[model samples]
Structures are given as C-alpha cells and as structure tokens.
Target: MQPIVHPVVGYLCYAGYVRASDGEAPQGELTVVAVFAAVLPDLIDQPLWLIGVTPVGRTVAHSLFGGALLVGAVGLLARRRGRTDIGVAFAIGYASHIAADIPWHVLAGDYHELGFLLWPVTGMPAYSGVKSLGTVGAVDITTLWLEAILFVAGAALWWNDGCPGVEVVRRYVG
Candidate 1:
C-alpha cells in the first residue's frame, strides 16, 4: 500500500475497534495518534532505505515484537497519565500497518519481509532483495486499487461518525 492508504486503513481499523469496544466511533487526539502510528513503520524504514542506510523497508519496525515494544513503551507513559485509551488506539493502529502489509508481502513472495514480523525469534534477512527504485515505486503505486476501495470504506466509516478528524482536533486543541 502507498503512504496515503496506511492512514485510511488506520482510521477505519481504529474506528472499528472503538465501535466494537465502546459501541461508538472514537474521536479526539487519540485518533490522531492512531493515524500516525499506522504509518510510523513505513515512514521510519523507507527513508533509511532510500538513503542507503538500510536495504530493506521492513526492519525491527515491521515485527510484531517491535510493534508491541513500541506500543508498550508508549503505553506505559499513557498509563501513568491515565490515558491508556490513547495507547491502545496507537497499538491497534501500529498493528493495522502490519496486517495491511502481510497480504502484499505474501502475494509478492517477499518472504524476507515477513520474517521480520517475528523479530528476534527470526533473525533478520539481509535485505529486501529488490534491486531498483522504479521497482519499489511501481510496487507502491500500482498496488493501490484495493487500497483505493479501502480508503473509500474508511472514509465512509469516518463520515458515519460525522468526519471527526478536524472537529475533534478543534475541540481538544482549541
């Protein structure tokens, strides 16, 4: 999925979680956290790869253990502040990124990408094994049809809750 699609998926997944847990859509700053958390993995690893710092998009960031550790560390802070809801939302968002990537990885036979999800339990594969920038861009852009539909679905979910992003921010940050 492209960068845009991750946040959409994050919003929908987080909203669904909120709806499931609270019988209503979630709102406020935590939604913002969830959205950023969803894309944090790609945002982190992609730049490093682009700069030749790493040869892979997936790293410790892509692993379940890594996600858990990140969310857990953030969670501890939130817990201390009595904001566990924020932590939980971010955790779910991070998990959603991994969930979104798995099918694509499997479809592409990028098994090395998947191994990182198991983290220390599975030693890192040396590189993504892709040789060209065009190939990477092609993969991200061309594979967006399903993501387009998912974006629409996620927008509908947010619309159902009255498109709360801006409104929630206004209320909380004003």
Candidate 2:
C-alpha cells in the first residue's frame, strides 16, 4: 500500500472499533497516536533498508514478533501512566497496517511476500532493487484508484466521527 493509505486505514479501523465498542468517537489526541502508529513500521524499516542496514524494507519492525514486542511494551508503559486507551489505539493502528499489507499478496497467492510477518523465523523476501524514496510516492493508475477509494471511504468515516484529530493538527500547525 502507499504511505498515505496506511494512516487513513488506521484511522478508519480505530474509529470504527471505538464507535462499535463504546458508541463514542475516539479522542483527537489518541487518534493522532493511532495515525502515527499506523506508519510506524515503515518509519522504522524504510530508513534502515535505505541505509543498507537491512536487506529489505520489511524487516524486524514489520514482523509479528517485533510488532508484538513494541505494542506490548508500549501498552505496559501506557497502563502504568494511566493511558490504556492510548495503548489500545496504538495496537489497533499497528495491527491495521500489517493487515492492510496482507490482502493483495493473499489474493495473488504469493505467500512468500508475507514471510516478513515472521521475520528471522521465516525470513523476508528479497529486495526489489528500489533505491530511492521517490518510488514510494510515485502513483501508478492502479494505486491511484485504490488510494482514491480508500480516501473517500476514510473521509466519510472521519466526517461521521465528527472529524476527530483535525483540531490536533490545527493546533500544531497554527
């Protein structure tokens, strides 16, 4: 998925889960946390791979083991700080990111592309020789269509949820 899709999906997932669980939209601050967590895997892995520290863009941070460890540690710390909601939001966002990456490979039956879920246990697939970050931002037609669909769905959901987190960004920016 493109970088933008991940966070939008994360927000959609978290907001839907919150509304279903409690009949209340998520708090803006925690929604922000969820959005950040959604892209956290790529944030960790991409830089390392770009710097030649990792063999692929999906390494430790993209693995189930690594993700679990990160979420668990963060959850525990959040609990200690009396912020379990923030922890849950983070978990939802991170899990949504991993889940979002799974479908196309599963549909294509390219199970090997999913080996990164297990990291060292299953090993990551070979890198595709993509050297520059520009490749990630480039939008081909298929990706553009998918992104458009996701954006519309996410926008509707965000509006329905009272546009949670918009105030947070406005505050930071202004």
Error of 1 at 116 (Å): 3.1
Residue 49 of model 1, lDDT score: 66
Worst 10 residues of 1 by lDDT: 129-138
Query: Any residue pairs clashing in model 1, and if so which?
Result: none
1-174, model 2: which lDDT tens digit per residue? 777789999998998888899898887899999999999999999999999998899888889999999999999999999999989999999999998887656544567888889997987887432122223456533434656699789978888878889899999999
TM-score of 2: 0.85
TM-score for each candidate, following the candidate numbering:
0.78, 0.85
lDDT of 1 at 78: 92
Angstrom error of the Cα, residue 110, model 2: value is: 1.1
